[model samples]
Target: MTLTQHWKEIVNLVTQGQRSSMHCAIASVGDDGVPNITPVGTVFLRDDHTAYFFDSYTSQFAKNVKSNPNVCLMAVNTKRSFWFSSFLKGKFSSAPGVRLYGTVGELREATEEEKSAVHQRIKPLSWTKGSKLLWSDFTQVRDISLTDFRPVQYPKMMEHLWN
Candidate 1:
């Protein structure tokens, strides 16, 4: 299918799911030009076309994006666990006028509105020993202009992978 059509399907899947958490991965060139992938949890979307994330000032993902400006995103719905997967990739940038990719950059500071939302949705989990904890007000937002997309009609085996 065309990119636009594929994007529509992806969006529908995400919107219909019970849980919609943003998946972010940044690729950094190693000493030998190989790429390293890091999974991060501080990601969000601003409306249907814009996306955002929160991270510490010293996060590797934020650092990598500032230096490289290349990033990838995946949104999955696992609650259903039948068959589903979606992903996105583009240059990681700031909302107003900051270009961050593979270097040190500031995370978007949360606004009062966002703070209100967090208070409503976030629940306090029990803390345990040996847990790596971090707190930051950094927010990262991006405007994604969907330029290309593709859809695959996978077999049952592959369908399980998507789910």
Candidate 2:
């Protein structure tokens, strides 16, 4: 299906994942063909089937993407309470997560708007030293052109949860 068909649902699940864990695991293939999964915290999804993430501390991921742009990003609502509630009811009120397959463009400087968005996202934690040490500077980004999506499924629990 085209992204437009399930765009809203994809967005919702991504938001849930972000709110729950503040990060996603993006898989890429390294030069030796081994898979690498990186925990990235700066993923930003757009309404137009695209996304981007800051590349501040992901040197290995950056090198892998340079060789092969294909990537699979998996984001799940990892909140303990959400999973507990689903287990109690034997069903999920919604899909718990999503996986997005996409191609990353060449890394480039982040724009003012993108920087501003990141600042806003981490504002609640801005006062903490850890926040300052970790999230203070986001200078580069790589744009992702999403091509496909797979909803996270738990057999019977996730049936009919599609948008």
Candidate 3:
């Protein structure tokens, strides 16, 4: 199926994962040819096929992306209730996880609109003292052009659905 066809499902899965865990894992290859994975909480999906993440605390990941733009982002719905219900029913009502393969664009200053959106997303944590220190200074972002989407499937758990 085309990427656009699955865009809505992918976005839903990603949003669920973000709400559950507050971050997604981004994988890239380092200069030593080793795989690097970083948990990034500032990632935001602009649309079905495009996303961007603030480049505040991703020094290693940024370096890896600069050398090899190819990257994969994985998000999982880790809510206890969702997992328990799915396992009990022996099927997932929706995808449990999703992987997005894409190429990273150059890092540039985040626009005012982007900053405002990010602030709104993290407003729940604004009461914490560390929120200011951690979320501030997100002046730059790296855009990702999603090229592929893969849903995590458990054959035994949802064989009938796939069939």
Candidate 4:
């Protein structure tokens, strides 16, 4: 389906996924035609069918994207409660996850608004060591123009959710 058709729900699921799993998987193709999956936690989706991610330590992912700009990003709600309840009830109130297909833009310097968004997102872990190690520095970003999406469906459970 077109990402625009389900943009809001897609955003909600992706945000929940990041919160539960701490990251989403972004797939890109290397020059050798091998696929690489990068788990990134700095992805931020906007109201439009666009998103940007902090390119702080993504050397490998960056190289892959440079070679081939096309990318697939999969975001899933991985919360135990979400899974347990859905499986137990044999139904899902909404989609459990979504995969977004887009093209990565050239890595560019982040704007003040972008920087503030990152800081705010990670403010809860401000004093933590891991946060300092991973999120303390983010100056560059890569934007993605989302075009398509695939819903994660569990045979019977999610059959009606998206209908």
Q: After superposition, how far is residue 51 of candidate 1 from its true place, in Å?
A: 0.2
Tell me the tens digit of each residue's lDDT in model 3 across 26-144: 99999899999999988888765899988888888889987899999999999999999998998888889999999999999999999998899899989888998898677899999
Regions of model 1 farther than 4 Å from truth:
1-8, 12-32, 83-106, 124-163
lDDT per residue for candidate 2 within 122-153, as digits (tens), equals 89999999998998878999899999998888
Which runs in model 2 stand beyond 4 Å of their true positions? none
What digit string (tens of lDDT, one per residue) describes model 4 on residues 1-163? Answer: 5666778889999999999998989999999999989999889999888999998777788999887999999989989999899888989877888899999999899999999999998999989999999888899999999888888887778767654
Highest lDDT scorer = 2
* TM, every model: 0.50, 0.96, 0.95, 0.96
lDDT values of the candidates? 0.39, 0.90, 0.88, 0.89
Write model 1 residue lDDT over 33-90, tens digit each, in one string. 4566655444444334444444444255444555555444444443322332222212
Alpha-carbon deviation at 21 in model 4, angstroms: 0.8
Candidate 2, 72: how far from true, in Å? 0.5
Residue pairs that clash (backbone atoms under 3 angstroms), model 2: none
Query: How many collisions per candidate?
Result: 16, 0, 0, 0
Candidate 1 matches the true fold with a TM-score of 0.50
Off by over 4 Å in 4: none
Model 1, residue 61: what's the lDDT?
A: 49
